[model samples]
Target: MTALGFLYPGHSAEDDYPRIEQLLGSDIRLPLVHTDIGEDAHRVDALLEMGSAARLAAGVEELRLSGAEAVVWACTSGSFVYGWQGAHDQVRSLARTAGLPASSTSFAFAHAARELGVRRVAIGATYPDDVAALFAAFLKDAGVEVVAVRGSGIITAAEVATWDEEQVLALARAADHPEAEAVLLPDTALHTASHIQALEAALGKPVLTANQVTVWEALRLADRRVNAPRLGTLFTKEPLVQVH
Candidate 1:
C-alpha cells in the first residue's frame, strides 16, 4: 500500500481522513498522528505555536514507522497563519525530519486550485475575519486570486468540528462570488468529507475543503492520483493543465 502520513493538531474532524482513505480505495493508507496543540485558539500567536517544529517533529517517527511515502500537516489555519514563507519553511523542516516529502493543507489549497485550472477562488473560513484574511493573503502569494472571503468568526477548531452539513453548505454559498472559479472552505477542523459532493452541487462549481485537499496533497507528493468522483471535481480526473 502507498501510505501517506498526516500530522494533525489536537482532535476535531480527523475522522474525515479515514473516511477519505476508504473512498480512495484499499491501495492507499492514511496514517495520522496527533500533534500537541498548545491552545486551540485561532489567534496568530497561538497558531504559530501550534505548528511549531517541535510539535510537528514529535509525530514524525510514528508516521515513518507506518511506512508513509509522504507526509502532510493537516491543519489549515495553523499553517497559513504563519504566512507563505513560514509555512514553506515549516513543511521543509518537517520533511527533513521525517526524511520524506512533506506539505500542509495551506499549500494544498493553492496547488489544488492550480490542479483544477482555477485562478480565482472564494474562501469560506471558520476562522475569525482577521485569521481568514491571513489565509486570503497566503493564497494571493501563491498566485491564486481571492475574489471573496466569508468567515464565520469561530475562534476554535473544537467549535468548527460541531458544524453540520447545512452550515458547511451555507458557508460555501456565502463565500461564492460570480467571478470565482472555485470555492474554498479552509479549515481542517471542519468535517467536510461527506459534504463535498453536496457542497459542489449546491454551488454549481467546484468546492475545495480542507480535509479533501489535504489528502489530495499527500497523493501529489507521493506522485500518485486516483479517481474518486464522489469526492468532488478535484478527484474526477487527471490533473488539469494548469492555467497561467
Candidate 2:
C-alpha cells in the first residue's frame, strides 16, 4: 500500500484516520503525526499566527524521516491565514523538505472547487465571522466565487471538536445557499468529514469538508485515486484532472 503522511496539531489518532480508512476502503496507508500547537483552546489562533513555510518545512522533514511518501499540512486555518501566496509557498517548501509531494487543506478546497468546475460556493465556518471572511478571500483568490458565508463564531479548536453531529448538520443547512454549487466546511478540527454525505443529501449539493478535501488533495499529489461514497460528493464524483 502507498503511504501518506499527515501533519496535524492537537487531535488524537482516534479522531481522524478511521474515517480516512473507511473512505479509502483499505487501499492506502496513512501515517499521521501531531506537532504541538500549544493546546486545543489556543491552537487555531496560534497556528494561524505562527504557521510559516519554515515551520511547515520542519514538520514535513519530521514526517519524511518517519517514512511518509507525501506530507500534508492538515489545518485549514493555518494555511489560509497565510493568504494565497503564502499557502503555495508553504506547500512548495514542504515538498522540498520531504523530497515528495505536499499539500494543505486550504489548497485542497481550491483544487476541489476547480476540479468540480464550481464558481459559486457557500462557506460554513466554525470560526468568527472575521476569520471566515479571510477564508472567503482566499477562496476568491483561487478563482472560486463566494456566494454566501456563515460563521458559527466558535472560539477554540477543542470546542469545535466537541460539536455534535446534529449541531453541525443544522449549521450546514443554515449556511447553504441556493446559488452555491458547493458548500465548504473549512475547519479540520470540526470533524466535518464523517457527516459530508448526510449534509450533501440535506442540501442537495456537493459538500466539501476540510478533512475530506485535505485527504483528497494529498491523494492527488501522490497520484492516487479513491472512490469513497461514504466520504461524500467529491469522492463519489469522478476524479478531477490535476490543476497545475
Candidate 3:
C-alpha cells in the first residue's frame, strides 16, 4: 500500500487530507500526523518562526509508527517564510528524521506548478499582503512566474480554516490575471480540497491550492501518483516525472 504521511501544523484546516484521500482511488492511503508547531498569528515572522525541524521531528516518528512510506511538512507559510533554501532544509531534515522521502507544501507548490506546465500564476492568498508577497517571491525564486497576487489579510490560521467555498472562490477570482495560466491558493489552513474542481470550473483554468499540491507532492516523493479526474488539470495531465 502507498501510504503518505503528512506532518501538518496544529492549526491547519482539518479536512484537506481527508478530502484528498476521498478524491483519490482506493489504491492509495493517506495518514496524517500533527505537531504543535504553529501559532495563531499569520504574520511573516510569526509564520516563519512557527515551525522547525525539531518541532517536526516527533511528527515523523508518529508517521513512521503509522506505516507511512513518506513524509511531508504540510504548512505553506511555515515552510516558505524561510526562503527557498530554508524550505529545502526543512524537508531534508524531516527525511533524515523519518528515514523516508520528504517534501514540503512550499516546494510542492513549485513542483505541482511545473507538473501542470504553469509558468505564470496568480495567487489567491489568505495571508496579509506582506505574507502573500513572501509566497509570490518564494514562487519567483523557485522559477515560477508570479503574474499577479492578492491577499485577504486574514490574521490567523484559525480564521482561515473556517472559510467556506464561496470565500475561497472569491479569492481565486480576485487574484486572477489575464497573463496567468492558473490561480494558486497557498495556505494549508484554507480548505481548498473539496472545492478544487468547482474553483477550476469557475475560473476556467487550473487552481493549485496548497493542500491539493501538498498531497500530490507527497505522492510523488513516495514515488507514487494518483490520477483523480476531479482534482482538475494537475491530476489529468501527464507530468514529466515518472509516476511509479
Candidate 4:
C-alpha cells in the first residue's frame, strides 16, 4: 500500500481523512497527524499562529513513525495567508524537518488547477473576505486567474465542519462564473471529500475542493496515481506539461 501522511490543523473535520481514504479506496494508507491546535484557531491570525514550523515538524515526526513517504500541510489559509513566497519557505522548512517530500494545500490547489488545464476559476471561500482574498493572491502567484469569488463569512472551522452537502453545493454554485473553467473551494475545514462528484455534476464543470486537491498533491509528491473518477477531474485527467 502507498502510505501518505497528512498534517491537519486542530480537531475540525476529523472525519475528512477517513472519508478521503474511503473515496480513494483501500489501495492506499493515509496516516494522519493533528497539530493539537485548539478550536479557537478559527481566525486567520490564530490559524497561522498555530501553523508554526515547530508544530508541523512535531506532527511530521509522528507521521514518519507510520512510514509516510510524503507529508502534506493540509491547512489552506494557514499556508496561503503568508503569501506565495512565504508559503514556499514554510514547505521547504517542513520538508527539511520531516526528512521527506513536503507540500501544502495552498500549493496543492495551484498545482492541481494547472494540472487540470484550468487558467481561470471561481472561488467558493468559507473564510471572511480578507482571508479569501489571500487565497486568490496565492493562486495568482501560481499563475492561475481568479475570475470570481464568494465568501461565506464563516469565522470558525467548527462551523464549517457542520456544513451539509446542500450548503457546500450552494457555495460552489454561487462561486461559479461564466468566465470560470472550474470552481475552487478553498477550505480544508469544510467537508468536501464526499461531495466532489456531486458538486461537479451540479456545476456542469470541474470543482476542486481543499481536501481533494490536498490528497492529489500528496499522491503526486509521492509519485502515485489513483485514477479514481469519483474524485473529480484532478484524479482522472492526464497531466499537462509541467506548469509548476
The alpha-carbon deviation from the true structure for residue 120 of candidate 2, after best TM-score superposition, in angstroms, is 0.4
TM-scores vs. true structure, each candidate: 0.98, 0.92, 0.96, 0.96
Q: Record all residue pairs in model 1 with backbone atoms less than 3 Å apart, i.e. clashing.
A: none
Across residues 142-175, which tens digit of lDDT does each residue of candidate 2 receive?
Answer: 9899999999888688788888789889888888
- Pairs that collide in candidate 4 are none
Q: List, residue by residue over 1-244, the lDDT tens digit for candidate 1.
A: 7999999999999999999998987599999999999988999899999999999999999999999999999988889988999999999999999999999999999999999889999999998999999999999999999999998989989999999999999889988999999999999999999999999899899999999999999999988879998899999857676422
As a whole number from 0 to 100, the lDDT of residue 154 in candidate 4 is: 86
**Ten contiguous residues with the weakest lDDT in model 3:** 235-244
Point out the worst 10-residue segment of candidate 1 by lDDT: 235-244
User: Between the candidate structures 2 and 3, which one is better when assessed by TM-score?
Assistant: 3
Q: Listing every candidate in turn, what is its Cα RMSD in Å to the true structure after a full C-alpha superposition?
A: 1.4, 2.1, 1.6, 1.3
**Model 1 residue 187 distance off true place after TM-score fit, in angstroms:** 0.4
lDDT of each: 0.93, 0.80, 0.85, 0.88
Indicate which candidate wins on lDDT. Answer: 1
